[model samples]
Target chain A: MTGQSTGQSTRQSTWYSTWYSTWHSAWKEQPLSFKLSSIIVVLVLCFGVINPFISYDPVLDVELSRRDLAPSWEYWMGTDGQGRSVALRLFKGIEAFFFPGLIAGLFAAFVGGVLGALCGYFGGWIGRSLSAVLELIDTLPRMVFLVLICTIFPPSILLISIISSVLFIPSIATIIRRKVEALGAEDYILAHVAHGFHPLKIISYHILWLQCRALLTRQMIFVFSYVLFIETALSYLGDYGVQEPYPSWGNMVAQSRISAVAWPWALPALAIIITIAALLAFGDGIARREEEVKR
Target chain B: MSEQTLVDVQDLVIEFDTPKGRVRVVDGVSFSVSPGEVLGILGESGSGKTMSTQAILGLIGGYPGVMGGQINLNDQGVTYELLKDLPSFISERRGQPEKNERAWRKHRYAQMKKLWGRAITSIFQNPRRSLDPLMTVGQQVKESIQARESHKDALERLNDQAQTEEALEWLAKVQMVDPARVYHSYPHELSGGMCQRAMIAVALACKPSILVADEPTTGLDATVRAQIVHLLQDLIKAEQCAMLYITHDIREMLYLADRVIVMRHGKVLEQVSANDLKEHALERHEYTQVLLDAAGMIGAHDE
Candidate 1:
């Protein structure tokens, strides 16, 4: 009995070692852009999660006497026209950027993935009607619709996220549906059906989880960047988004319009550019890796 | 033909809608297979040899699928018609093939779900594409075997070591060189012959009474093709299962099949014994003679 137990332990160890080596090698083979973008994304996510709890000097504590103060030892960056610390407000804006996009991305991916799989797998009247509704959403003017929603409801991260998720679902669902339609014709699907596997299991696990994982990940990441852009754009328009004294990135940019020099706007603008670029690059990297695996 | 008939298909007619009009793919083709028997369906491309088997397997779908047919299976002594309710869901119309597609599909799925992979299983032509690419060979084979157990037991047996051992045994039974390595390997990693072997292992793991091999050796190389044919022959004899072997190669069919059914243009020309055809003792159709000639057997017999 002891000898048998020893043999089993050795077998398990060998299996673990082999799996670890393969995963390590795969990570090493990733492209430079993917690695860089991954590091930046992880850092941004860490800051987003941990930054809110750490209290700093208040950005809303206005001081008219210290308005337009230049960069000095007291302020790392500088004071804005409203006499608020630019760096503190930038730190607070991280939550606004990260949380809404995350919510919207998750909502869209889950809903769209299910809808697309159904439409693509069983294409009949159900597919036709669902596709018709999606197309109607697609034809509507996006900017005009967003503006209308913002005006009707008080603009907040939760409300904006929900609206963006609804808007993003049709596109994601359409993509998933097209992919399902193409893969449905393959022989593997027919073989699985003949094998007596449940159609729902095959569609969800085999088709979605195994086959279309990379495509779905890329789409989800792209949605994050889109939400970030929309939030900042609305905040910058002045009347809507986050409101005064809230220190959102968009309102911060609006505050910079008073000064002649571009330094006040530089920090927020750089934050938006860097975050969106990193997201796009990360998505592109995933797509490139998927192609390589296929080859 | 002393053993009981496992599956009996009679007067199966399949049609598809085209841009021009409706075209019949399998026009009233019929055959049956008994336990421990090999029935070869010999035909050229587009001869509907595959279509007839697909119809029996209930894998047909889309517009005008299996328009008129009777596919009956004596599943463990309980016989039932596979296409009994198809007519009720179909409606005849002028200049068009109108079908209540959703209802037909629902009915067909309900009828076939219990029998597929349990009573009947099939090995398709392209083995590489037929096997799921993401799953390991062992996992897929294990899934087939696990489907035999009760649902509650299957859930508890999800990580059971016995199924893994059983799957490895199946791999060895199919004559794989190294069962352990091949068990963990993905479908894309193996050669064509190895993939076909894995596919056969998966099909037989369920312990079904009937196996449908649709041109299993078509895309393989010459040596691999011969080896696969030999492996299939040995498995059929050992398992004592009924098989419907579909192929266009007259020579291989003659060597492997007990009886031959020659088909052309969606019709069966003749059904002859393989031994009689080999000795040129039985009367054969012109198409069968043409196939024999192409296989270079006629000249050899004459010489």
Candidate 2:
């Protein structure tokens, strides 16, 4: 009888967990538009990765005779001033431009989220100190600071990415800090403490889960947009991703601008604009889903 | 009269430090709870009943309260001199007072954490705020079980997993309907009586030797109030667990308490057995008469 009862409980627990997981999934499932955009982004990223190794030669084929050739099968995205295939070059630029921004944003979000959660939960002097530091960082012009850091350092893709991440951290931290502060005041946390749950357990299992879910989802969209903007800005400025062997949407547009009457810059420029637009659309969908789940 | 004293309080005083000045809440109160006995503490609002309990739980930190007294729990083999120069000093001598102050304080706190649900548990007045809104009723009970059973061996641990079943059983003990469905529901989903029943299940999860129920039925409806009282009476008799039922209701004191202690303005006005209270209603004391009159008022209100 005892064994049967135990088995029954086990089944009940399994059913409970499965039901909870399904409910949670329903709450968090990405919207159709966001999912579609995400698919496009992934496909684009994959194409960027595979292009150089497959059909396109992004470097080493100087078409001096055919410089600034406009749209044809031989040069699908036309050729830039250096005779590099604008399409293939743009694909190569993905590694230097987009990836760095992605990494920087993610790193910043992670650090900010964790720090904010700790500060909010613990409060008192620790929270105050973190807030002070975050405020000081927030006071600076982050984009200018990123430019200054890149200028001071021997600008590698890694250094630029790190600089971008540093720029992003304080704002994300402040957002997460506010979220944590709100969650800390919840009755569940007090209940956990009253029941003698350890401080670490209360912070980790109760407070972090409560605050991080919505903030992290919101941060993902922010990071995606911010990274794209930073990468494009860097490329436009000619501080990075400008040399002949390197291909970037910003540099291609820059090159196209110089010889606009001779060559059409629309295709590559359109691709850049389209990719950013798609990302923004995707982020909006995600934001909507997050809002719905929060409700 | 001492089979084993679970809690002993002598001249317990609690003062809160406000911006204006020091305000004494619980002044010179003395009481004791023995094993397997119910001690009903009856008091008016702001009479220091809640504050005194909070002091016992060591939750009144930095509230500007000076608690001066000795509280000894014989079952835990610990005595606490509540009011000392430092907060650390009081906590140090809490449970098992013989260990070095610093080490004993750490040990006592740790021990309290371990013993909370198993040896001593509490039921709050507001069941809504007392439970986690995010968690299912079952999970909260499971959490209490996990806390108390942290040190149990494997077979005993299996029994601990049976806590949910035990909790469900306790639901029936509390006269709750459809325990299984109620267990799966959230706090807000349940009615006030059901929520209180779930709280009782959580309190009894670890089979505590002493249960501190802080106004268990104050906010409940009249019908639900009687049911809750009856449920508590049944559980108390069945489990033989000592209970400290804190309430302002004098009738509830007479109905549920083996012995009752009445308080006014943080001072104990009267303490008497339920039988003595009924038999000597007019002659015992003026405070006793006041309590009886209060009970009569509640009876009239019920009518």
Candidate 3:
């Protein structure tokens, strides 16, 4: 038994090694710029998680007297009107902003993608019904819907993300639907069907994987931008992270609105602009690199 | 022609409904193959050679198309009345039955799930389109094996390991040297001939009883096409599997097929044993002679 088990493990490892070697070779063949951009995006996502816990306290700090201090060693990104450190606020904001958006985006993409693929792959009634639903969603004023939902429900970070994600579903579904329709016509799918593969297996194993990487890269950028926009809008309206001790870039900048005549509370606002610009620039770079890899 | 007919199709008719109205693509065609026999269907580009066999395999793509025929598989003693049922209905009959028609339909739908990569397989004309670009040659072949049998034993002790071993064997059988290295390489990395060989390896991995090859060597260079034809012939003989070779190349049909069926305008024009071509020469079916002349096999019996 022991000998057999060891031999089994050896074969399993060999299979894994074979898979790994092929994957690694493909990755290694990618251009240097794509590799570098992918690395940077991964690092930024990691930092978003780690920065709040290890580096700073984004909450529970106040100095009424030192409110709106300029950038200094004491407060690297200076302070908001509430005298909270902008660096700490930015770190925590990253956490609150990224997570809900990522979760919501992934959920929406998965639902919409599967639905779209089914519609495009097995047409006639199924395709028609899905297309009708998608078109109905597309015709709605999504931003207005988000605002109405946010007003009806409590204005928490999670609720806002869900609403924002729901708003983007129709658009994403449309993109995925077109892709699946085109891929359904590809010869590989026909060949698989000719070999008598089940429709479900053809879609899941072949069609889904064929489109997944590109879909993911596109979704990442769209979700990232939309999350930041929604968060900013909510913060400006004094609906999100509104409690005094809690810090969000939107709310921090909103506080400085009255004191535009005073010292640099504008530093937090600058941080918001800088963060958004940086993330968008970084996302674009990553998107370009992904395209380069395909080439 | 029975050495036990492996596949028998009788009175096959395929029609497609278009905006212009219904038009027949394969009108009243019938043929059969004995075990280890190669049956060639020869035609021009729009002659329905591919459609006739696709109907047999129950793989007609949605073109508002309908097929009516009786296909009998001698090994299983099952007769599939293809025209009487929809493609989905025909598919359901592959496996054992369930309690009701609905239940059986579900089972039949599930049958493709179970039978693919095992019972019946196909090789296509374009190797690049047929192969998954992302997968290594070996993994693609292994995927077929892994998909077919659920091996519960330890990986090393699994009986299905023989199937993977057979994939490499089939690759070597197709004259692919360095099968190990080729197995690890992606489809794009290989030449057209090598890709076709890898495809054959996957098709034959499960030792399917019948292999449907649709213009399998159509786009290949002459030498490569000859090699593929020879490889397929040898594999079919050694495995004792029936082959449905669809082609427009009459020379290839004559070289490789044991029996030949010529199709034109969605109908079978003539059926002849490969050995009987010379005797049939005086019976000048004009179209058939034209094909024979085009293939450079016409005799000096008449102008």
Candidate 4:
């Protein structure tokens, strides 16, 4: 009974302490970039939440009568060439961009981490061949290669994300390889081996799991930023991005051109810039925190 | 208990292949360890004490090249070769070292994991870096205890409770007064001496026949070192386990070892019983004589 009570109290204390520290470290005394990035992310999340209820179309619902309008209370971010609410379009664009970026980020990290673990842990012919393939992909111009693949098949958010994830895999894999190699040499890992833990278990649970938690989160954000860049570039070119009627930041900015007295593409362009910057700053914050802990 | 050989390692040879030639790191080293025996294998840093111990664990091949000989262990009336049937290096991959290492590791991992902790365990040199920083002391000890068994329901109720109970018993055995706190704390929360004691508890958790302690007290300060050494000595007697105490501190072996084997450059130069060690006449080899002279025990004669 005494043992149980002691266990409970210790458990509670550890739990409370962990929660308190994470918040204090991540929020309080953080740099300006970290605060600004967090605010941007929260704003984006707010838009994503309210986006589904908003009824606004930038493509087909073209009120030619109200072609160019400035910012107003009725039309908060004004109307575009197609009489679409820019504020409404901004929310939808954020939703479209963030969703695919998130998917691509996860896919890239998973593939990269697994491939890199295999290479570092199980080396030899398998590692060598996979490394060669990664080198082959590394030299190709990302935009041109993505365009080529998209053109060959019907391009959408799914196809573009798949291509971008594949492109990001090698770089992420390289990072994971270096991490795994260094970690594999650590004595604690060898201790696991001495304790009769399986090599696969050692690789997955002990070596990789503990080390890669924060690292993978940071890497995914970086990958998310990359995916965001690719999506916007493809959208601007009017190819391989989300089609018209669906307001992707890329297409909303792409299918419309900038003009004096009416900047149709301005809001989406600015949204793209802010979202990418937010991702980078957030990732950098996490990375910096990791470094501090190491010291 | 009557004297019975728990470990009989025969003519062990460990070699690494370089472009120049096949270099033998540990050549034809052999020793037998009986139960309740504290046999010190004293040598310098590069004298292959640790590498030779790896051969006993079927881990020498984990690096590269060839390892030949038998590491026989007698467990429950069944005698088995710990280093037998391990794949030999093929000449086909003479040019490619990576393929050679990959092939060796696959086999070495399988063979080593079977005999690890259950049959033979080790306490490493650096105690702080040896414990996993993420896991609590209790969790690590529990894993070592559970490793002795084949398999149990990991998610079953009270499984953790039972493991913790058993782990705390080990902590208590290692003379840890506050077992409860030590069990709950992480590696970083403990001092270096405390961590080393925890590591000993971890090693003794399984109650294996042979414990290889490779310079286990190297990093501890003077007072803590004496305490830890005394703790280990008492535990070895109480557990009746054989210990291959590998260390470079030649003078300290007298306190811990019953019989000492002096090694130099991967070869056993002299093996002396503790009684004969005091006589100094048994240390015939020039290096052993030189070491004893350096320790100021044996005077050099102007022959």
Candidate 5:
């Protein structure tokens, strides 16, 4: 009995090893940028989820006695000018911008996908008028427009995200519209039209779902990364973003200007750069795969 | 035979504004098809054989398309007038077709939507490309089936099993070797002939009154083309549906079409019965004679 149990365990171990090796080899075959971006995104999400439980109270509570402390066991990124844990604030900062970025990205994807599909599929006066309106919106100075809106309305994460998403809509819609137009001219699409399928059905099921899904996802990630950059820039400008005592990356970076130590500003700035770069790389990787599939 | 005309197209005119200026692709083309009849439009490339059918199907678009036409459909117990009030929507200025582009599109498209699929369906030239690559043959056939079938019961749709059974039946009717396998396979997995068969199955699944086949055999090999043509002939006969068979090949046209209309330079040259052509009973036009000579039918007839 003992010998039989040992033999069965050996067989199971071999099966497990074989499955793992196959999975590992498949992962290795992916593009370098895809792997890197995926890893960063996963790590960021993990940190974001565990942040509230792991981060100390230094994010909000001021401890003047521990001011400008160097990196230590208790303080991972060391303390800032106000004796707040920079590491804890950075984790909180991820939460601050991430949710809002997601909201804005989803908004752009849904609204822009529908509008673009309509404009591209029906290219008569509807296409003409829609293109005209989008082009008019495109001509506006985005930063200036954003700043004006921020000033007029009370600055909040949701409002900022929504405003930036509106500015990004025209561009996203333009890309999708071009894709739909090119696809609409294909013989298969015309055949679908001839087969008497409704225009909405064709656009959604065939055009958007089957053909343009990757492009839409890539565009969504692009909007997410863009929102992150905009948020960081606004926060860095002080007065307009999350105020002091709130643990946003921009406000933390704002606290670093007078501090003699460099870790506080450098750490958050680095986080900002790495997050945006990873998101962009992930989107571009998807785009490259899409093009390869097309070829 | 005094059968009711299923489709009557009269004085159809279609134009396009090219860089060179306005070109009338279909000029005063008139034809009609009765149930269980095959009306073949025989022409070489750029001869407007396809355009006239496109107009009848309401598939014509672009600037100034179908400028003047009257297509009347008598099918499914509904006598509908296609291209009604078309002239009211269009005006000619210095030979350029002009109108309120927005209103015309809105009105004409809404009018055309009612006739598509159930009243009139079409099989496009390239079969592989025409079938949605992403959808299985069964799914596409099921979709076309569901388009009109659900309307029969007035809200209660066919269950999945029933739809699948119907789709497989259609695949078998189109002469698919293995209906079950073909049902599960996507268009890309099938051969060119098989793809065309699937396309036929999709088009016929709705049981349309009229089927417009545009160069259905253009891309197939000799044997496959012959097989497809035979299959189409048998299916049309069995279903008793009117077909608008468009082809440049004279022999195929003569073999399949009951009545043949030979066209060139966007004008109809001759309209004669296929039996009359075979028997040399009528004095054909010079262009029709040229086509006959090209097809080597005259030599065969003399022998």
Candidate 6:
């Protein structure tokens, strides 16, 4: 009876069955730390991607009458200096942080993937020169550089994301390049070579196919969190980033710069911390899993 | 079975520039295989058997040292000046080598890629490692078949039912019992022998006329090894293809090969028919006699 049922399920599910099994097995195999981090990362990603639809924050809702109120049932986490609901703005703040992070992460991953694969797969003057360029970028002080660039020419949100993404390329590409080098040495790749596969075919099918997904995903998540933190830091510093009249987590906290005892601004600061911590933890888990699978 | 020559390697010399300066790994190695012939290469570690095979396929990287020789595809009437034809990043980095070598290398690689997996294919020494971990045995075989096309043409064509069916047929030809199950399974999911069979299936998928198998059954246990050799022997006969079987096991060569080349110190010492090794072990070259003694084959000279 069970065999018949399994056959029916296999027929009905088709590709989904294999997909689900792979997914389930992967989840089942992860350590507790991986699971916990994955959960935190997933929740943050859900909030980041869907927060716009779920959150209705009036960034321009100036109500001086309700300014500086503490957390209450009606005004969750209280109102900011400009009478903006801190809780509502917190979600919108995530959306602000998230969209930029996503864009920058994607940009970095695309550029990094191509450059790294090419350099590692075809090592010569090309690889060396490209490596030299990456090294130059790598040596830059990311925090100070971004701050200086953004201050010199006040950046729009998109421009800020692009800058962060550009800065991220070196580190991400270094990881990808190292992976291509290591994977190139594996025997399966030699097998592909023996099969008389085109170098491009060997790269795409035999080498990059498995390694790219995990590497890119982990790097993307890391870049996302990195840009989010930098955006917040720049805005909080009052010179660059999302700027005023906007409801980002950083600017909201900056606008609310209150005495520590009152503790209302602490709310936005906490959200930023959780998001960054979750992203790092999630990236770490993926790295660990990648190492394990290589065994 | 046929007199047509398929592959001819002439005076191939491979030198490596190590920390200890230049050293020759394969010195003036020369041999050829006709269609439907099993030509065995017997040698110890570092005998250049594997290197010579790799040199034929341009697997050897251009380095501080160099390779010089010719690997000709007699049937295709194409000659690969194995030395200049393979891409060498090191050569480019070393400054001037007359850009002509690089162009020829690129041109040769492109031309070789056209014939790879179609006219010539290979099975490597390590069976399990030779199969992609993330892919099913079937997918790897199908991809090899697909590689028979132009790169752009391959992208437009995705996995079709016909290719999968053909892949399954190959698995069955390799003596796989449940071809369907094996087709869907990943390399890690199969046993070593099973993976070796799958490797064979993949290499044979495009019906490559010249198959280069480098120690394909080296590490398997006796039973599996015998079966694999038997299966390979049967298939090579059935397909009427030429095979360069590289191994150190003289017994295997005796059983599966028509001609056996004895190698030592990166050079071919003797080329004789397999039957002559048993009947005229001590009567041929000194190296062949040494190999026979090592194999414990008592000859008239042993007394």
Q: Give the range of the ten consecutive residues with the poorest summed lDDT in model 2 chain B.
A: B92-101
Candidate 4 per-residue C-alpha lDDT over B1-303 given as tens digits, one digit per residue, 9 for 90 to 100? 112777887777777767897677787888888878999998888888888886676555344544566778766456776666644544445464322566566666666665787778888899988898866787788777767654335454346566667777777777775777887787888899999999999888777778889899998998888888899999988888889998877656878899888887888787888657766543467887667777776753322
Q: At residue B144, what lDDT does model 4 achieve?
A: 79
Among the numbered candidates, top lDDT falls to: 1
| Per-residue alpha-carbon lDDT of candidate 6 for residues A1-295, written as tens digits (9 for 90 to 100) | 1222212111222346644655566578877766776787777778777776763537567787788888899888888776778777877777777888889999998898888898897777899999999989988998888878887786666777888788889887888899899888777787687677778867765556566766787788888888878878888776477766667877776776653336666888888887777778777666566555544
TM-score of the A chain in candidate 5? 0.85
Residue-by-residue lDDT tens digits, candidate 3, A212-294 = 54565567566765776777777777565434456666776676675534644465566556555555555555444434433
Error of 2 at B222 (Å): 3.2
- DockQ for candidate 6: 0.35
- Model 2 alpha-carbon miss at residue A137, Å: 2.9
- Report the Cα lDDT for candidate 3: 0.67
Ranking by TM-score: 1, 6, 4, 5, 3, 2
> Would you estimate the TM-scores of all the predictions?
0.91, 0.76, 0.84, 0.87, 0.86, 0.89
Query: Which run of 10 residues does model 2 chain A get worst, by summed lDDT?
Result: A1-10
Whole-model lDDT per candidate? 0.80, 0.68, 0.67, 0.75, 0.80, 0.76
Which regions of candidate 3 are displaced past 4 Å? Answer: A1-40, A51-58, A238-243, A260-295, B1-3, B75-77, B84-119, B150-164, B278-284, B299-303
Query: What range of 10 consecutive residues in model 6 chain B has the weakest lDDT sum?
Result: B92-101
The DockQ assigned to candidate 4 is 0.31
- The candidate, 1 or 4, that scores higher on lDDT is 1
- Note the chain A TM-score of all models in turn: 0.87, 0.79, 0.78, 0.88, 0.85, 0.86
Q: What TM value does model 1 have?
A: 0.91
For candidate 2, the TM-score is: 0.76
Q: Between which residue pairs do clashes occur in model 3?
A: B68-B83, B92-B108
List candidate 4 segments past 4 Å from native: A1-9, A12-24, A45-67, A255-264, A291-295, B1-3, B18-20, B61-66, B86-105, B149-158, B168-189, B279-284, B298-303
